[model samples]
Target: MGRTFHRYKPQKIFEKELQTSEFYDCKEKKWVAVIPKMKYRFVIALKSDYPREVFDAPKYYMMKVVWKNGKEQVFEADTKDALGDAILRFRTNECFWNNLGRYAYRVYLDWVNKSGRLLQ
Candidate 1:
């Protein structure tokens, strides 16, 4: 054989520059996604305390998504594989374009690490 061609690896896209924090959710009884940079600090609301409009905002609320199989679930940052799979499936399957596509896109950006494995 004169020559052989092999697939070339692309340059790494993620810089690993983002800072992340692990917070425990006492109500959910599980670890939540790493908190990204915020312009303002988040307020914690106690069950016994008064209700605040800011606390009910979408940004402060935990993101919940429904799967294609009709099961609803909360998206977590710790589970990269599941998020990656969902991203891939969402991109490839047109039927899911309307349902969980929006949530999957958000999770894709959240869970994708420096390795960029989910992009592949």
Candidate 2:
């Protein structure tokens, strides 16, 4: 057996919005589609609930997405710290921080570093 390591392939989609596919609403007979694919994206997930913060500073963007039988994984957009929270709210909105914002994103990174939250 050999050890395996994941290469640092930052997802480009993290800087953008997350979208999802659409299914035909048989009852309504309406072709519905989610603007962004949130199936495997967290930044996109943020938009589903938090739109205003999507463009907030600090610029939190999606990094990556992984799925297992009962778990998920994700990553961030920028390597540098500091920025506003206005755009960082969404995991997809990428941008560099100013100065003070660096610390804020660092703290946020604590939660951001997690692969995924356990489904309670």
Cα TM-score per model:
0.26, 0.21
Q: Looking at candidate 2, what is the lDDT of residue 20? A: 38
In each prediction, how many residue pairs overlap at the backbone (N, C-alpha, C within less than 3 A)? 0, 24
Candidate 2 segments exceeding 4 Å error: 1-56, 79-120
The model with the greatest lDDT is 1
Q: Write the per-residue lDDT of candidate 2 for residues 1-120, one digit (tens) a residue.
A: 975543333234322222336434545656566455323223222212233333443334443333222244443434322222433554342222221223334434544445353323
Q: For residues 1-120, could you state the per-residue lDDT of candidate 1 as single tens digits?
A: 665444332222221121234433555656566445211111111121222333332221222443323464443222446444544555654444433444346544643443355543
* Candidate 2 residue 64 C-alpha distance from true site, Å: 3.8
Clashes of 2: 24
What TM-score does model 2 achieve against the real structure? 0.21
